[model samples]
Target: LDVPCKVVITAPEGEDPHPRFGKVEMSHAKHRNVSCVSCHHMFDGCGDFQKCADCHIDRDDRSYERGFYKAWHSESEISCRGCHKAMKAKNEQTGPIGCLQGCHEAAQK
Candidate 1:
């Protein structure tokens, strides 16, 4: 609900922390000045949480044009690199951020 908030995702006391998905903590550092509605665009008072892949499907099999990739890295206003670059220009110290070198670590494998 606010910047720098810690959203703890927990499971039952004895159960595995990740019965299905692992623990998730939504950080606000990257999006400190951004509003929740910017990313959760479908939220209108109340709505279900939809995964990025739900709408950003790999239709043409092109990594650059893929919905999920484009959604966060293309010409969109909220692109990660775009914002980081801007921050860097402002001397905000967004050190060495890039698609391959930063966010998507699994892609390296």
Candidate 2:
């Protein structure tokens, strides 16, 4: 659980959790707004972060031997962006997308 570390501000009593967890904040802000796109996708303005295991079952050819947790979380609980950023420079030379492109593709304007 990446709680407290990145949960940012907690909701006041009965304030509504949806606004606090919804895309409006992330779309309009950064840092204080956590971009969840690394593990999620927005389709028709709907955000979905289906866990990796749903698609990566043992019967699947692309399934990893170590399991979804290992494949997705790496050895530690590093976010997907963290892994992408770790390879940003090397990916630059290879012409692959870096962390910036991988997640925050839409530049804040």
Candidate 3:
């Protein structure tokens, strides 16, 4: 019910939790003024769990087709960078780091 909540999603032990594990804090300022339905458009019915790459795949014109990686880094309206830049401008202390340290944490090596 609140933004910036710490959501912990876990997988069964020994299962491959490749991308996600441990704990993550939601974007407090990003979703604070919006409703859940804005993003979870299918909340009213049962359907496949939506992944970012599901609708964010690159266009057929060879513009962008790398899947999740491209989508996450894209500066488009739907991508994380779009809002992260704004957040950073508003507050340097709590602003997002695009993908340098946030989602790409594992890739830092």
Best by TM-score: 1
Name model 1 segments beyond 4 Å from true.
1-33, 59-66, 106-109
Task: Give the Cα lDDT of each candidate.
Answer: 0.53, 0.35, 0.46
| lDDT tens readout by residue for model 2, 1-109 | 2323322222234444333132111212323333555434322334454444454344333235444323333422243434444556456322113323323333332
lDDT by residue (tens digit), candidate 3, 51-80: 443554443333464543444445553445
Task: Assess candidate 2 and give its TM-score to the true structure.
Answer: 0.27
Stretches of candidate 3 off by over 4 Å are 1-34, 37-49, 58-67, 92-95
Q: In candidate 2, how many Å is residue 45 off?
A: 3.7
Candidate 1, TM-score vs. the true structure? 0.51
**Native-referenced Cα lDDT, model 2:** 0.35
Per-residue error (Å), model 3, residue 71: 2.4
Top candidate, metric lDDT: 1
Assess every candidate by TM-score. Answer: 0.51, 0.27, 0.43
Higher-ranked by lDDT: 1 or 3: 1
Residue-wise C-alpha lDDT for candidate 1, range 1-109, written one tens digit per residue = 2334544333334555423334434456655667767665665756565655566655344466545446555644455556566778789877335644545433345
Residue pairs in candidate 3 whose N, alpha carbon or C atoms collide under 3 angstroms:
58-64
